[model samples]
Target: MNVILIGYMASGKSTIGRVLAEKLNHHFIDLDDYIEKKEQISIGNIFKSKGEIYFRKLEKKYLKAILENENHVVLSLGGGTPCYGDNMNLILNDANSISIYLKTSIAALVSRLKNEKSKRPLIAHIETDDLLAEFIGKHLFERSQYYNLAETKIVTDGKAGTEIVEELMATLL
Candidate 1:
């Protein structure tokens, strides 16, 4: 079986996925990182060079490849992965996988993302916390429909990494 972690940026999918995979003795694959490795280019650069439409197509292709061909894996998807095309349906229809959404509040996202804006291409230009929060609020509103389709939802505010992982383990087990 495979475990797919879905959430907005700074929601700890990749970080928590690595630990969850280790605990489950499964391979960990961050979809964005996998794409970067496979394409030999960063996702940011992919967006810059080929644009979001092209990048989303690549994302859907690679996501389908991973979901169809892999097992015993913990996959962390990009923030918008499920929101595009038929990706959420694809994920949901995969018989061997379970999807979890790490639901974080906009305030928490703002706090976590404020310092890391430089690292995220989407919000890199957001000048203030207020603007960042506004952007996140709007984005999350739009994306929540896709995110909520996950089989499980975990509210992550004020939770330590271990705490969240433990909760996840309990749910999975």
Candidate 2:
């Protein structure tokens, strides 16, 4: 079985995926890290060199390859994975996979992102409160439709990591 976690940036997909995989005795894969390792370049660098269109094509190919594995695993997808291509459909078609969406408030996301703004290329340029708000709002609006297609949705606003994990465990089990 494969448990896939999907959500926007700062939604705790990677952290929760690691814990969940450990608990379930399954392999854990973070899609971004996988891409970086396979392509031998940072995602930021990929975007800089080849542009988002090329990076997204690579993301789809990698996602397809990973989905072919039969072993039980927990996969954490990139924030924008489902927003482009047929990635969401590919995930949904996997009978052994269960998709979970971590729903977080814009306020909570903004607060969490502030701490790691330097690391995120997409939001790095967002400086003022107004700009950040607008940036998040626009991106969220674009991504929410894809995120909503997940098999299960859990709100993580203000919740501790373990708390969210527990909720996910309950739902999955």
Candidate 3:
């Protein structure tokens, strides 16, 4: 089975997925990292060089490839992965996959993301906390529809990585 983790940016998908994969004895694949390795460029660079349209296309292609070919894997998707193309449907339609949304509040996301904006291409230009918060609020509201379709939802606010992992393990069982 493949466990797909989806959520807004800074929602701990990759962090929790690594531990979850260790416990489940599954391979952990961060889709962004997978794309970087395949494209030989950072996701940030991908956006800068090829543009978001191109990046999203690559995301959709690689996402389909991974879902179709991988097994016993914990895959963490990019923030906008499900919002583009038919990616959510592809994930939902897969019989061997379990989709989990690591839901995080906008305030929590703002706090977590403020320090790491440079690492994220989408919000790197957001200069102020108020603007960052506003962006997150609007973006989360927009993306919630796609994210909520996940087979499982786990709230990650005020939770440690291990606690989230434990909750995911229990949910998986």
List, residue by residue over 82-166, the lDDT tens digit for candidate 1.
9999999999999999999999999999999999887888999999999999999999999999999999999999999999999
- Name the candidate that leads on lDDT: 1
* Per-model TM against the reference: 0.98, 0.96, 0.98
Angstrom error at residue 29, model 1: 0.1
lDDT of 2 by residue, 1-173 (tens): 89999999988999999999998889999999999999999998998899999999999999899999656989999999988989999999988899999998888888888878778878888887667877888999999999999999999987889999899999988
Better of 1 and 2 by TM-score: 1
lDDT of each: 0.97, 0.91, 0.96
TM-score of 2: 0.96
Candidate 1 least-lDDT 10 residues: 116-125
**Runs in model 3 lying further than 4 Å from the true structure:** none
Candidate 3 backbone collisions, by pair: none
Candidate 1 wrong stretches, greater than 4 Å: none
